[model samples]
Structures are given as structure tokens and as C-alpha cells.
Target: MVIQHGGRPEELRAAREECAEELGGEPTAPLADDAELSKFYDLQVEAYECLVANGYSPAPPSTREAFVASYYAGESWFAHQPAVPEGAPIPDTVCPQPMLADIEW
Candidate 1:
């Protein structure tokens, strides 16, 4: 909703909570397995390298193990840090999130 609606994080978060409440825990799923993690990490690294090549500044990515641990802890990690100059917009071609194929998202 934030991507389309352009709302504050707090508002978006509250909306998410409201939606979750309405669902009443109707859906649940298991975490990704090791093979899935390996595949995703590989793709993420490639995408991060591409972003860096395009002049997007990002810190070195965490080790796959560390990243998996953090992922399980619900921590968010961005390959590119948002350091856009004042009054500047990110280029449409510069994507922070990787597009994964042949894998369930």
C-alpha cells in the first residue's frame, strides 16, 4: 500500500496491523529452508553488485548465515542505503529490492 498510496510508515504499519487483525491468523507458513536461503542469498548478492555498479552506495552485505539469522529475527536489510540528495528522486532503474524468479516469493 505504501508503494502505491504514498503514506507515512506509521500509518502504513497501523494499516497492516488492522489488516492482520481482520485476518485473525488465518494463514501461516513455514520458514524457508537452507536450499532456499542459499538461492536467495546468491540472487541478492548479484543484485547488490549490480546496484553498486550503477553508483548506488551500499555497505558490504552480511554473511549468508548472519543474514539468515537476522531474517528470522524480522530485521530488515537494504542492499542500497537511501542517501538521495535533497530534492532528488531515485532513478526508476535503480531498484533496492531484487527481483527473484524460479522461486516462491
Candidate 2:
């Protein structure tokens, strides 16, 4: 049960609240890029390959039941690679503090 509405932060928040009222639970953000947020460009190669394999066509509109059937029917699909590039080292993503302990200036 995924809601695919597109909107701004305030609008999205409002929509989430409305949804929570009807659904009765905390809303979950789809954190798809948690594993390889830094290596997005590198992963695009594998996705391109998969897209080219399945008749090189875009996905068709369908219901949840139809979508599941289409998915398992060996239709065209995309997938990203697991590993990051060797030369492009992973970044240090720590949040910076407002004031430094030892200021020279």
C-alpha cells in the first residue's frame, strides 16, 4: 500500500498525516539509497544494461496484481550494481559542528 503523490515538504507532511489518520501507523520513508548514496553514477551502468535487455521499452501501467504478474514474467527491468568504484573512495558523512574547538583565526 504505497502512496505515490508528488508534492512539497509541507504538502507531503499534510498528506502523510491524512494517510496516517486513515491507515493508523507511523509513515515510512522509502530509503532506497541508504546502501550506496555516494555511488549513484557508478551504479547507472548496470541499470542501463537491464533496461536494454527487455525489448528496450518502458514499463506499462497496471494494477498491483498485474504488476506482480508482469514482474515475474521475465519482462524488462533495471538493477544497480552492489560495489562502489575503487578510485572513488567513500566520503566521510559526519555532520559538522557550528563552532570549532581550536580556532586559529
User: In lDDT terms, which candidate is top?
Assistant: 1
Q: What is the C-alpha lDDT of each candidate?
A: 0.63, 0.38
Model 2 misplaced regions, further than 4 Å: 1-6, 27-105
lDDT: worst 10-residue window of model 2: 94-103
Candidate 2 lDDT tens digits, 1-105? 566658688878878887888789685665323223223322333333454453333232233333334443544122321133232322213212111122222
Clashing pairs in 1: none
Cα shift from native, residue 50, model 1 (Å): 0.7
lDDT of 2 at 80: 22
Residue pairs in clash, model 2: none
TM-score of 1: 0.53
TM-score of predicted model 2? 0.23
